[model samples]
Target: GATDADAAVAVAHPNIALVKYWGKRDEALFLPVTGSLSMTLDIYPTTTAVRLIDEPADVVVLNGRPAVGEAYTRVARFLDLVRSRAHRTEHAMVVSTNAGPTGAGLASSASGFAALATAAAAAYRLDADDRALSRLARRGSGSASRSIFGGFVVWHAGDGDGTAGDLSSYAEPIGGEALDPALVVAVVDHASKAVSSRDAMRRTVATSPFYRPWADSSEIDLVEMQKAIARQDLPAVGEIAERNALGMHASMLAARPGIRYLSPQSIAVLDAVLALRADGVAAYATIDAGPNVTVLCARADAARVTAALRAVGDFVDPRTAHLGPGATLVPGED
Candidate 1:
């Protein structure tokens, strides 16, 4: 049903990795040191449209303003990849909008690039499968590979076997419908991060002594996480996710000069999550490279989790999200 078109718009949602993807094995290829498992959230969808224009240069507009700095560079570079694949030299205009804050640990880049990759593939008439698109999205953001699928997904680290190994690094969906978990996203802060995640990861990999140990343990965590999801064990899933995320932060914290993304507000939310769990609620906390925290709990406990998070009085807002669908090309949703 999908074919080449003059222009196309696509939508995708961000995915929060439970087993945490911290450092990259291949920086240029965006391959992780260890594989990761995640749940694609139903919230914060990114919509992007790409249209070929008869212009000398590509144009990029993000969230209602002309993209500048790293944002513009990433979009243009990703487009270059698509151009090379499609074998079309025509420049294009890319317009994108994110429903939530970008680069603030909300996985905005994940959804943004997934949507862009889908749109570009369709616009350029590149007949590629979902796995192929996942690889394409990974060029823009490491986690974006998982955004290609819905529900629970896994991104394989593949091998370090050069070009052939790169093919194994795409994300794929793993069934977990029975879990039906809910994620309560606590937004403590939404401002742009001073240090980008990529930079932070590089620093941690290069400097932190804890990085290797954590990376080693993460592989075992991934195995347990997959088992937990397979058996529909919400508490196990939550616990593994929380500890893995905390370990990721620990590695970052141990970096030379030490980098910290968790603020007082972030810790407050985390404490609340623990409190909820102690109070007989199946809840656990996970944080990304930024200050915000996401609470994992059973679907039935989402409202209670949200209320408890709000009572912490630290977050700007807290909302519940469920499993989301994969990226898709929309005819007019843009």
Candidate 2:
């Protein structure tokens, strides 16, 4: 039997969605109300190691520090899922580190859970294909499903009301080379989010009148975005991405009491992105559940986008990202 001293490690990168996924149809299963499309980025990976132990409870260490509070609970629950799947009662020790700050709306959970799923699955000697692994990652974080693949990926929300089981939701790669682009990440704030994306998502789905519209429009956006990627139409892709992201924010805003993730700095960066477009630089901005903004542009325009964003002074640091690889199990420490 494998001992706690023997660990399995894995690495996975974050992804930014062009077509956003906001609400969940089934929270327990982490099934989204609509499908989403995203590009896995080469920057800011999360490396995780898992070791099954004979202890009574799971242990989690993050970034060289013992994880506590909600973070520890989440990790323990996710490991419980892994243990259940493998039909093993042994608790585990999971240690993970994010290359960048966590919970800054940079999809840290996506990469973290993807890495954890990869490492834990291997450590437990579970037999799962890429699709099954993606589904397993999704149970930890909805966006994590996309991190299981590289390049352009689409997480299908899947069809079912409990009958479809685990197969109902999984992510797969979408083929397209002409539309390969770079993402300019403008880091406005690195602090952990005050209100979790999970809470905001639940509020939006339960109260926002625009929730239905957003879900409906996202379906259309997903189809059109796929076409844009296939044809390598930068303008079409940018337009769809910008509109889809804004629409997602709008839905959240319409929730009861409203959930505003965008800050003044986020808007300022948005202004700079628009100015670059007016100057014939094809740059479009998208944001997640935090104040940071990401600008999508041709790989050749990375410098221009970065410079323009820096000029705005709304971001402390601006970085560039390209298409990244899928999560993988490694023999040694990541």
Candidate 3:
């Protein structure tokens, strides 16, 4: 068994995909239809502590409980991948905590997997950069491929073959890539989402007629979003992101056993955002597998956006909304 004192900890934040990744071409490798853009949030993230133990019973403890069975298998498989390059080492005990709600449809898995990959790599003294660590993290969760880096990140969805996919999977560091730092205002938190992202994507890919169109158009969206980011064009970026997110959800609606993540409150919040845009507010909303909405706005306009959200009924959390940092090691501690 491992003691707390012997553990190495890493902290990483969940990222919101600006260019949403909906359908996957290869389920086993978690390959997406096209590249996705994301920004790591500073407020909500996962912190993981990993320590090597001198026992054969590799174990994982998440939020205080012993992670057994499937969860253990998943983490073990990831560790096995890292161990292939790293020298054979003792089993490890890992404890993970998500700053945000675990099953709230947020990208907790992205940060959780990234933090685990980083802590595991550090605990074993593995020589790896952000990209290498990202590749390892991607094996654990598809969205996690971008969480390995901070600021802005793009995950290039390569060809379906494992080898080609690995080579094509690229993560770019775009934290300061834009001339202006963008701000993401979270409008709602803890809204109940009916379907989990995993289930939604699986169903969408298997049944949605619109899935093919979404996949086909992702390349254009990727190119335009990148250009908008490069130019620091907030309006262009927001337009592209909102459209991409809508496209993703549309596919979900087209699924055989169709389901909608949008709740009455979700639609209300979306309408409010559009109203803000019409009123000349430079803001837009994007959602993922959850009803919670994140608003993309300029850092300077964050206060105004927050005020606008507060003016609405008790549908949003003012405190939970804020700008965030990318995936990084804990200062002074790591």
Candidate 4:
């Protein structure tokens, strides 16, 4: 009954974590140790299409090239999950593209897996709601769960039994619509980092002395962050985000081999953020697992924030992004 005509396409945007979760408790299930909060951005979305094929193996194309090695393997494994759920035998042809640089700490995998999970679930005729879809996306990438929702989203780190935890862990949109902030992304490096986030996280969890302390402190920060968002306090939110990110990096620095993602240029952007605050501007910076820095500020201050980042370094290419909608199926795109 299944045919190539049974195809689906979906698009999803990247998200930057304000209160980030670093390590995982269950690596196989991709369950995080702590919950994280993020804001989905309007820029650099990934669009993916899944078409069932009668062939023996799945075909994967990523950003115009034939997906190979780990990229192809990850896609096939994710589709295998869909197949198991839908009771389908057909392999799929997966095509994915990103509007921005991939694997540069810009949440490329987040958007990619979010779109893939949506498209694959539909193509396999699996009846899934948003919560179910978010869980499915988490199997591919941890941050991808947040990409399933719009605006301010939180990914809950479920506890207790494995089955119950898997069922409970998912992302939902929180109430932060009043802030309407803009995130200025400072592109300090376009190339992918030598160490993947998974590897770095594992190392930090295993060897870092500061990991436990930061995790404990981050729990308190998350509670305070939710209250700040509830009060629509932008400065409070920025302060929490900046300190949380810095604490995460400190944990990384305490690792055995010292996994450092921030560079000189990253420090320069951070300096600019501090200078903006000194001048009474509400700008705060958050760095992911790479050299790039994303500054969160009011939409009115986005231009000022972008200008400051650009002036700091010749390598920094700043782009202003705002809150974006959640993942959706886009019809009529072949």
Winning model by TM-score: 4
TM-score of each: 0.97, 0.97, 0.89, 0.98
Give per-residue CA lDDT, model 3, range 199-298, as digits (tens).
7898999999999898777778988988888887889888998999899888888899986887777787788788899999988888888777788887
Location of the lowest summed lDDT over 10 successive residues in candidate 1: 1-10
In order, the Cα lDDT scores of the candidates are 0.91, 0.91, 0.77, 0.93
> For each predicted model, how many residue pairs clash, with residues at least 3 apart or on different chains?
0, 0, 2, 0
Q: How would you order the candidates by TM-score, starting with the best?
A: 4, 2, 1, 3
Which consecutive 10 residues in model 2 have the weakest lDDT in total? Answer: 1-10
Q: Which candidate number would show the highest lDDT if scored against the true structure?
A: 4
lDDT preference between candidates 1 and 4, better one = 4
CA shift at 220, candidate 1, in angstroms? 0.2
Tens digits of per-residue lDDT, candidate 1, 1-334, equal 2223478999999999999889887898898899999999999999999988888888999999999988889999998999899988888889999999888999999999999999999888888899999999998999999999999999999986568668889999999778999998999888988889999999999999999999999999999999999999998999899999999999999999688999999988888887887899999999998999999998899999999988999444997899999999996633
Ranking by lDDT: 4, 2, 1, 3
Per-residue lDDT of 253-334 in model 2, one digit per residue for the tens? 9999899999999999999998998899999989999999999999999998999889988455899999999999886552
lDDT of 3 at 69: 75
Model 4, position 70, has a per-residue lDDT of 86
Error of 2 at 187 (Å): 0.7
Off-target runs (Cα >4 Å) in candidate 2 are: 1-6, 163-165, 332-334
Q: Candidate 1: where are CA atoms >4 Å away?
A: 1-5, 332-334
